[model samples]
Target: MKKIYLFLLALCWAGVSFGGDFVVIVSKDCPLASVSTTDLKRLYTGKLENIDGTSVSGTNLSMDNPAAVSFLSEIVGMATTDYKSFWLAQQIRGGSTAPAVKKSVSDMISYVKDNANAVGYVPKDAALDGVKAVEVK
Candidate 1:
């Protein structure tokens, strides 16, 4: 029984570590050095249109990706279904749109590289050729 309990605890820890194996990234030239979680949530949910008076955009990976799922759950604080519904509600209220969804992590990185004001999350070890990870508060 003790061994089984230890194994389960280890399994849970592995899951948490695996899910956390990603980074929130932005263009290397982006204005902000770090972002509070509140600001990030606002930016992603479309409640915010700018950061430090500079127009900024958010990008999302398709929820089918484990990185995306983990990002949504841990950082965004929503499951895929809730995130979709929240976006739908925002759209219906006539003011916001969901973040652009990228097909893959590479695509997400490319987006951040090209869009100076864009923010996204990708696997921690993903090649960050033209982008940089921002500290999340």
Candidate 2:
């Protein structure tokens, strides 16, 4: 019974760690309140620019960050490796530039807080004092 309880506990902890409950955050001054997942995917993939009339500058977390992986795979519809490859091809072809990447969650928050047009994502549990989260539908 004790072994079973411990195993369940470990499973729960793993779920908490890998679960993708990320929120799309932007500067508090941003006019929009929420955005759809489709729109978000478009914005991140460079297929669309600006959300509703507000120019959007997208920021990304480092490639190795789990949140980044989730955002890329779950939200952006691309694996991290494939995403990097796509961006590299775009860059080589003189297409639109990739979003700026921050090394940590704190750095991502700081960048979004400072840039009024910026949009980024962080884990739902992250402290978002200066930024506002846009509901992902």
Candidate 3:
């Protein structure tokens, strides 16, 4: 029983240590102001056509980061492997291209803030103001 309890405790610790955080950001004046989980998923998945009544577009930072992966898995409800496969299939099908992927968090934040209809995700601790944080369910 002690050994089982030790193993469970270690597992919980590892989970907590490995988890990452991210924030979905939009311009302060984005048309459709707030976002629910459904809205966010729609926007990220290219299912939504617009933001604040205008055409919608979003960008994502490099997928190699933990925070980026966490956002996809936790907020978007997509496992890492499955998400990669989905993007790959989209590319093969020539579906509406994926979001313009940024190389760094700063670049993503800059692009989203400068483009009225653009949205993107960054680390939760990224220091930027005037960008609205969309709460994910």
Candidate 4:
């Protein structure tokens, strides 16, 4: 039992280490090609109205998904509850609400490609056909 538990722990740790890599992406027509963490935070919080001068708007994959949570904690540095609460406060303060979350990375990618101004992040291995990957600092 102890050996099995240890093996499971090792497996989980390996998965986390291997799984955290991610990529930020935007539509080809999106004005911005890359973004800083500051800009991303602003955009996610609705403080920045535009990316590369065009209006920015769109949703990301939801917190309930592991990849989404990993992206938030590893890339954006916010825990799920904190991230949602942050957006809620932003909405209450008249800042734009957090973008509506999609059900899957595939759905998010499709949504972003169609929306022009939409942007999102996904696991690094995910296919990026229509969207351009952005460098996130």
Candidate 5:
């Protein structure tokens, strides 16, 4: 029983540590072509509003999405709970609300398609017809 429990614990940790690839995306009309990790973090945390003179708004998938899990750990360099807590504190301090959350990949993609300033991430192979992948620098 103990061995089974231990194996399950290891499996969950491995899932978080070894999440799949994700790509940041924006509407094809966005002027910016790429973004730095530092700036990407700042944007998500609401410390930034524009990149290279173009106004930008960041969005995230709902907390449960695997792609969001990957984005937080890999690109944002934050654990899920820590990221949630940071946004909670930010709101308590009267700072901006956290980025909007889309409930599904289709919703996220549709949002970016409709909002030219929106930037978001999804599973690497997710359909990206009206959106263009933004290189992470």
Candidate 6:
């Protein structure tokens, strides 16, 4: 039992430490070709209203998702707990809510593909048939 627990813990740690790269995606119809991490952080945090003349909305995967954790910590500069606390305070203060949460990568892909103003992130291996991947600098 102890060995099993240790193995599982190592597996989870490996996944977090060496997760696949992720891409920020937007609808193909969106005019912007790419976005910097600064701009992405702004968009996701509701600081930016538009990108390159197109109105933009952001979506996030479930808080517990590994990709979500990576994006929040590496790109958004916040831990999962900190991100949640920030949003919670924003809500209590009657500010804008957090980005809509997608249940899975497929849901995120579908939402970004269908909504011209939407932006989202997914594991780089995920299918990206209709949406455009934005280069992160």
Q: lDDT winner among the candidates?
A: 5
Q: In model 6, which range of ten residues has the least summed lDDT? A: 12-21
lDDT of 3 by residue, 9-119 (tens): 988755433345877778877765556666667777767867556777867778897777887886578976777787788889888677788999878877888887887
lDDT of 1 by residue, 37-111 (tens): 778788888878787777888899988888888888877799999998988888889977789999998899988
For candidate 1, the lDDT comes to 0.83
Which stretches of candidate 1 lie above 4 Å from their native place?
A: 1-19
lDDT of 5 by residue, 16-120 (tens): 334457889999889879898778889999999989999999999998998998888876788889999999999999999899999999999999988889999
**Which residue pairs of candidate 3 clash?**
31-52, 32-52
Candidate 1, number of clashes: 0
Q: On residues 3-116, what C-alpha lDDT tens digit does candidate 6 reach at each position? A: 999999988755443343677888898887877778788887778878777888889999888889888888888999999998999899998868999999999988898998
Query: Which of the predicted structures, 2 or 3, would earn the higher lDDT when compared with the native?
Result: 2
TM-score pick, better of 3 and 6: 6
Provide the lDDT at 6 for model 5: 100
- Give candidate 5's whole-model lDDT: 0.88
In model 3, the number of clashes is 2
Tens digits of per-residue lDDT for model 2 on 1-137? 99999999888765433347677899999997878777888888787788889899778999888888888888788999999999999999999989899999999999899989999999878999899988665
Give the 10-residue window scoring lowest on summed lDDT in candidate 3: 12-21
Residue range with the least summed lDDT across 10 consecutive positions in model 4: 13-22
Give the per-residue lDDT digits (tens) of candidate 4, residues 7-51: 999887654443466678889988776677667777766677676
Candidate 3 residue spans exceeding 4 A from truth? 1-20
* TM per candidate: 0.81, 0.83, 0.75, 0.75, 0.84, 0.82
* Candidate 3 accuracy as lDDT: 0.74
The reply for model 5, stretches above 4 Å from the true place, is: 1-20
Structural RMSD, model 1: 5.7
lDDT of 6: 0.83
User: Residue 106 of model 3: what lDDT?
Assistant: 78
